[model samples]
Target: MPRNRPLAAVLTTVVLATLTAAVTTAVTTAPVAAGTAGPKTVIANLFEWNWPSVGAECGASLGPRGYGYVQVSPPQEHVRGQEWWVAYQPVSYRIESRKGTRAQFQSMVIACHAAGVKVIVDAVVNHMANTDKSGPGWAGSAWTHYDYPGTYQVQDFHHCGRNGNDDIVNYNDRYEVQNCELANLADLDTGAAYVRDRLAGYLNDLLSLGVDGFRMDASKHMPAADIAALRSRLSRPVYIVQEVIYGAGEPIGPLEYTGNGDVHEFRYGKDLARVFRDERLAYLNNFGEGWGYIPSNVANVFVDNHDTQRDVPGTLTYRDNGIYALANAFMLAWPYGSPTVMSSYEFTDRNQGPPSDSAGRTNNSTCYSGGWRCEHRWPVIANMVGFRNAVAGTGVVNWYDNGWQHIAFGRGSAGYISINDEDFAVTGRSYRTNMPAGRYCDVIHGEKSGSGCTGPVVTVDSGGWFRADIAAHDAVAIHAGARIS
Candidate 1:
């Protein structure tokens, strides 16, 4: 298990003061490229967002909400198309795509860094574009099927063919899964030194532009050795969480790539979704390893990703506003793996792009307008970000549940939360907390302004308890950071 790192300047609280004096210092602010993550650290995946809009969001919301990093869409040149999948296909390593130009990409990095937020780009090194798609791509770079000008040649890609069309049809075979074409997209032969060098150069260029890490696309298709080789060439290890979706019976597993970095845990989302939607609140008392998931430090957990929201059945999404917010609140409040909040725009079709102007350029997102759901901006979810940060490094404490509808817990003395998931409401229920006697703002209901709370206030007595009556499908959350007096 990875130990939680202490913050540089700890929050000036009685508990934090003692934690600070533990004396053995740890990692912070040096880019979360690779290591066991701290509890306070959370990254938000801003899928399909362009540069200017992302920069604005970094300044307006992300940094203030305590997000340590933002994983953006692939910024390299890709097929000049509107569909979201176009980003996963590459035309060249040139930092030019629908998101923005190289200059705009650099500017966005600078802007995010100014707000103390790091940028982790979605690095699609697994494949080039399909042969059917001829490319004078988004940045006007002309290319043929296997020839990327000034970089990869036809020899750089694998020609493995088990199926007649060279597509990967056998998931059970390791060789076929790694070397064959995925969805008929051109697969790169990542093992060759020439191929490794070109891939490393592309990532190193991003590093020069102040990128902190990468979300390795199709990492399951590439050997762990190939990724480790690519990382060895870099000056230092950067955060690299691979997209390797493996369950109980998969041939290849996430352990294969842990040497390189972390993997975005798909199982974590599926497990939580089942209990929350079914209103099985009792099973959650033992929510972490008992439910079968990766450990807290190594796993990058989320409630839903861009793909799962559209394709995966029974997964909670922004459409399920009441239920989805409830799940997100649970994910944040629980001391599980390092969490990633999904901040995405709304889409009816699976292939729809962001809201665009007449010229097909992505319009600046107004979030609530322009089809952007912007769940990160929701008051309940936004305030929970601070709640999670304040309670960093603390274990779950004072766990209380009514065996069905209501469940309440504390994070040492830093925070406390009670969730009511049943159809009926509960009134004036006394709940135990670990916090000292004081009135705290329930951040999920509203924010604490100046000396007043915009939400309901909970006053914990000298004995560390409070009485709160929450409605069905509602939650109550309070932390020491928001204590008004």
Candidate 2:
């Protein structure tokens, strides 16, 4: 499922339209597990981008654009492979993975921190490399099955021998899922105190480096009790977003993990895709618990991720630009789960590594290439980051829908957005924009370019209504950040 396509243009736009293209964005710090009480900003999963690219852009690009954090690839030693998932199978906590070396990683963190972009790394604590032969890892750490040179021994691993070889078979049984190896990856005995100490040491090593949070990978595979215990061992309250996919008949649910931190709402992307694609806009009035995606505070939402982009159906990817952009607008505008923007490369093969050199290091010539696709750079998506931040604590008031495809809503009195999902244009009609009598920049399509608007200019009267025409598959979003009129 790797998409091999030329990278599109670097997405560009400004909310106020005052800054140049390479402007330094003054990033606003936000909390994780976003809700109405969520982070003031959002996260960008820089899938497989190297430390140099990450460090370089922190000040020049991301911070200026108002991103709260960047969830980077696993920055630990692992099996050397061109496939993406190999990073998840760690060899050591050496800070020398495919992304960068130890010094480069530290420098990147310092740079991002200086830019006000918190770094949340993907922490893989569930297992080790799924290898048959013993060899040195990317960081030159040697290890055999459950036996590293100076670390874990054979006793450190679990012996949940399902299918007679420790490979997980019965996912319905919670024990096999947690204790047994996943896809031949060696399962760690997380219940052991010694193992917990070792895990904490690695995590503390990262914490010492000023990492603000962690995205716990395959969190469901580890028992909730163990995760809580692991959190207890942490030195501080680092933001945690557990990766737990709640699918059919899964016994260990996200509710069990919420006591510690947020859980990624895997269903959000799939659900929204279906809702908007079928023109089921009116049914979303009760979008949070009414649609069963509730307990808003602990939910981390996204349109798609590195995993779902290739495999899961009904996810809005880069391929479907119009509908995908609409879904992203709704995600940012909606006040439910805390949203994380997905930034990935263009690929037809799902497992293809990022654009890199022969040694598998990132080729960071352009911010994106035929190999890299930075979705967060898109004007609509990037500006929405500012919009969400602008309307952070506000409630979704002035909800409007045609009882069919078209819809509009106000985030308190701070921001307003309208979507015309119908095939035909809605012309010569007045819509309740819920704004004061003034001129505002429609940031969905463009930005303010000085005293002028690059997108469209909407004139609102005293009654909070505007006579406007909206096209098919397009939306209009305006917030306090870009309001000139």
Candidate 3:
């Protein structure tokens, strides 16, 4: 049941204005602290895997790897395997999905938190379960298009005639996107009083469970004003990221959700993929505004997402090669939107589930075992995670470039990095790093016997400059805290 419309609407407005104003005031008044840098680079996309698996995987992989957060798949109750999109067809605000039981979900959340990694659940509140579908969900809830007897029923859905077409043809038309069905999924009347109460209850539940934020799916498919309304009713400072995939000239782009939260900068991944893989390395220095990108702080950058990995063609070509290393390395090194590194399991067919048994129980793919390849476990990618963590809050100072295929930059005085992707060896280039005089460890290619680092000491003199050679097809990162500097 929905809540009172007029009152809910008024409350929502007040919340949005207060939260937005508070954040704005903080940004304006707070001076930059010495070590309190800008954003950090540690984000992970949790595919549609179960809770136990997520906990086990994050504990074993991401937790130890020092990822700042893990963006888990939708946790709402949904139709079970009517199609993969069934998850998009949310049935109710229950923590029971294909992932795991409520207890398991809570355990995963606790485990991730204990490991110093935050959890961001993929929220699908824009609409509800698709109409006319009948199936039992992970929570044993049965749903139908027009009727949900004794379970969950929303009578205010748009009439059948209104959503006759499949694609949303009008970008400027806000109502059609917000009130219309997405991919034939049921549309909820968010303005309804009962609906607002239920949705807010669900969000509050997640917050109580120690979840950090949300990655709103198909955000463009909803009305920005309504989203703003929904966000306001929640507690202050909930990290919200919207998925609005747009290219250069798309009329309805991410700007619509500017004040709401960070919008997914799909263009960054596409452009970075091309430049890092096929083009010369010199093209990297002229990043950020040179490539016509949104400011780094307001964007959520990724190399590939679930939709693009499965649907978009030509976006991801080198999922198994050195190009992946170079592309991800550049994303971590460069100042961009909050970066999210994808951790995928190898699959011959796009729709195939994670490594599973004959009875359909999902299981982990071993690193040494030849069944699946977990890209996050790769040495190059994992090492870069450490580099990004070490250089947190530093500006890109002392950028050096030997034309294309050779580039270098330092992050505030904390860390310095250089890369060479050319076919031949590149050397004899140096830059000012601004660190104290002493030797520091190069995170990449250095020895890591214990939990910390050792080897490849970089000596930054009193002049704040150092000389280093960049090997072909490889990258190097040096930090201040590891070695005496």
Candidate 4:
């Protein structure tokens, strides 16, 4: 069903020489930042994999790929059900849940750490367990409406009702948001002394197990003051990323959490997806600013996340877009935000459990197997992982675009990339690629062969400019240090 196009004739040797010369001149003369660390790109959206499955799948696959970190599923105790939402219901601070036992979770943390991949746990501390009439949770912990046995009780929650619903409805009212139930899930009072200590203890426990940071869910529902206080008590330097989904005009936004850690750049993902998939090429040149973007360094960008993929109406479907693969390639190639790539299993319904058998047991399905769809392993997507690591910390320079179909750019002379999304061939293009004189690999199309690239070797001459022709619906990336000039 998928067809690969041939290299365009316009990408001739003569044009490449000219572009390479221009690129070199620009880079060599530009002023450099003192001791500036190059881009550190991290690609992870560790989907619905429970703890054991994460260890089994991510530990071995992501580490050697040079990923800076892996975003894991929530490790707290959750409700017991055949549906996926059960995990969103937090009953206790125990590491034990349906994903795996405590030992399996710890093993995954250790394994990922050993492989050079930092682990960021999804923390649902904004609330306690849901008040469902169901008995106990997956961890066998008894739970009441706002009471968590042996952990916390309803007295720890703020007693407030809005329109006959006990849940907090006032977003403008910060107090209610932090103390009210989210989707009927029991809300915890982070300001409470005992609650703060218990949460800190839970976080400290995760830190002891080698967790690098956290993804705070339902963060918009928590008060900024309380969150900062809690963050102060936790292990310093934790990679804290808060989920404050602010789109268009929702009032509450990500700005409140910037002091705590990096906030999810939800708007960036939507804008980029639109420009890359539906809009014209002219819109992409100002990619960040064109959409009222955030500072690239702090934004956590992704094409489509678990929640949006499932709930957003009329949005781009992941299955329809071979575009997802292309989007990820562009994200990795571009030095924009701290990128996160989603790794998900196939499901018929939005609420269906992950790759599980009839008994509701999570199973490790192999590639081409019926249940799991490991998009991360796709050749195009997997290869970009290496590309991101190779050019980490480099700023975008020598940017070029051909109409709305093709885009080419370089990252601090460390790497250069070209992408073509049109159906027709592109020709006569020379752009500056500030890398030194050397032969480099086009990673998108070629695998690393020995010390140099085996196919599509981009040679930067004594000058900086080079001619580049990209086939329709194709992408090519050239990185430094891979070949001899």
Candidate 5:
């Protein structure tokens, strides 16, 4: 769900103002899971992309680039508005919104599956539309604040009689955080069996239509036990990643929800940004557990998501340009957590939705032409997907950093990468890795073409040493999968 303005201010100031250390001393990294149906664990968050655009991207880019999953914004019918947050304010579970009609959404799923990519929906189950407004939803379903004709009723919500408006004001109190409204949006009584069944039914509907998984939105507002009950109601097991923002000293943290499934490691993007902008890139050598984040296996990490791109202060967004690409390159090269590459559209206003018609139907995305900033398609980010897949199950080795903005590392003998964030070029440096001797494409700058590369190529000698000059804020990555000879 997109962050609400009023609530965003509170969350930015109170909950996420401080970057705290990891809450638990968990395992460093979980062993990579055995092969599954999808290509890999890399997810492309195509936020606000229409269903047709999503389907086309599957065949045109996602499949070719080795993306395992694509997470779409909430597909349910939403309030009538051009603001992006309206998608988060559900009026009904109908699969009709500015994104597309239900048929179009189903087609997108089929196309993605055909392309060997799984679909993960951003499921908004914690609340309904803001109680203040009432009208026909996007799908023509008449809905009031707490009442949907064929879905939920007033009793399905939690009228937490705290703060005058019932909106969450105290992050320290677990009960208030879970039961109170978030930005005055009607909070669902998730603990209630009836409400849980309704939410599960909506998710099951998506599964029936071939959705492979779900990104549980606003999971922090629901107790872990309640979420488990909702999961139990699922028709079958589907991949689940819950959004449990880790607030410092908060009673309920992201770790508590790991039992349910993978949790969004919010700290990753923030800490990563801090290192890229203010701290040293060498510090990323001890990025994950050393930085006190959640266990790598059950953590879902991203450089910047839709919300953080606008609301969070410390993270990097598309505006960072080449430096942002370098950050993503490092993320893909580093075996930290399951990485999600965020593909966003240009937005001058926080509430501005994707490019849409007068009636609010989203237009087809014209990458790099219209508002779409297809970051996932960027050379450094897209090509690195293959690098990540090639280095799967391999641990970091031959790590090196210049004690500041330059760092290099290898994943066993499968892949190697060196990122230089210094203001000037670091020339004539020979970086040693465990990769086999061969002519490999420098995936960061150019992709592998037939028998060669389109950009600068790096040759590793028999002794596993590669000599190259890295430019300021640039990177060079070579993987076994892209070896030319």
Candidate 6:
């Protein structure tokens, strides 16, 4: 059900005429370090990527580009199928699936750690596969609806009698939402001690394999207290980000899960898309909590994750083209929650799986070909990872906007970026910052080459100002880490 849940929150678009206005604000906090020795929270979600491909990416692109963590899809054995949703249908806790075998999974983790990147596995512990029929799992484990051999049986599941079936219908009912089956899948009785121990045993098995964290799949169906209880059973303290999607008036909201760990701020992406599509860019000045989101510190934000890209309309995805890159740029440059850059495969069919062989083993992604659209490797998005790390703890300063589709801001003296979404090109503009006078490579369009830049190089004078022209729906970013010596 993780792949099929519907969004309960309704986002409204506000249209208004462009206005002219200027705003400035300055805030400072203790600097946080990123890179090898410090905390690097930026995540690259390589959805549906096979183990080998994920490991290769860590060495070739993710590590060198400064991405600290790579969030991979679930690794457990799942129901035999080619659809991506099949990955969410847990047949067993064994680390075997279309992705790879247990040994391959361990090797991938080792490779990632070697490249200074941690691995975060997607954990689907809410329920098992839909029990419409009985079948053999990908790893040859036989399962039928609510039963799996050597695993849980009928007594371990919740059989809430409702809607002529156990399927969840009324989301407003807390008991039904938590206890009833979702999408005909067998729901686990998480509150039961035996079931909790079984789930924790599965997670501890993963911890033994060197996983750094987990993205708890379908956390909404499992109560926040249940998840906290599950965490207490972990072998060691690992980073946990729960997928408690926010619904407008739902009794079970994201705030209830903060004590557990970081919760996905579903509002950030939907509201961001609304502003970019129908509203003005100036509205982003007071983004984050000011816009009614969770506390920034524990808020995990993304433009469009795997679920949102397909299910939640209006949220920016890889399909938005240049606008998508600009949105990612804005997300990385601005001081907000820890952001995740989505890497997706091109698909016309929503349920279609990634490129795979006849036996359903995922093929290696060549990027920009063979149906793999590696957005994480795009020049603008990849280089911006470095920008985010460089400006980690700085606060927004010298904020400037044209009150419509143009805006610029500085991350203290660490970095600065100007984005223009207007139809016409914005030219002959000088942006002032507190960064020391130096030559910096516009990371959005180029890279640092030797003592110079491979593309446009902007020079800041003694006054900490640089003049540049930005094309429609484009961005220019410069940071201290990419300064040309």
What is the per-residue lDDT of model 3 for residues 268-330, given as tens digits with 9 covering 90 to 100?
Answer: 777766666567667777676567766677898877777666644446532425556667777
Of 2 and 4, the candidate ranking higher by TM-score = 2
Model 1 lDDT tens row, 1-485 = 11122421232232222211211232112211111123437788888888998888887777767778888999998887677788888998999877788999999999999877899999998899997667788788888878888878889999896799889998888899899999988899999999999899999999999999999999999999999999998866788888888756768888778878888778878877877755566678878667666665678888998878886555777766666777888888898887888878778898888776665567776766667777776666767777888888899998888877578899998899998876556897898887999988887776677677877998999999899988766788998778889
Give me the runs in candidate 5 sitting further than 4 Å from their true place.
1-39
Alpha-carbon lDDT, every model = 0.79, 0.78, 0.66, 0.69, 0.85, 0.83
- Clashes per candidate, residues 3 or more apart or on different chains: 2, 18, 10, 24, 1, 0
Quote each prediction's TM-score.
0.90, 0.90, 0.82, 0.86, 0.92, 0.92
lDDT string, candidate 5, 50-84, tens digits = 99999988877787778899999999999998888
- The TM-score of candidate 2 is 0.90
Model 3 CA RMSD to the hidden true structure, in angstroms: 13.3
After superposing candidate 4, which stretches have Cα over 4 Å from the reference?
Answer: 1-40, 168-176, 312-317, 452-455
> Model 2, residue 373: displacement in angstroms?
0.8
User: Residue 470 CA error for candidate 2 (Å)?
Assistant: 1.2
Give the root-mean-square deviation of each candidate in angstroms.
9.6, 5.9, 13.3, 8.0, 9.0, 8.1
Per residue, candidate 4 scores C-alpha lDDT tens digits across 47-95 of: 7676665665554566545566788878788877777777787888888
Q: Which is the better candidate, 2 or 3, if ranked by lDDT?
A: 2
Clashing pairs in 3: 1-194, 2-193, 2-194, 2-195, 3-193, 3-194, 37-393, 132-145, 281-405, 282-404
Worst 10 residues of 2 by lDDT: 7-16
Q: Candidate 4, residue 93: CA error in Å? A: 1.6
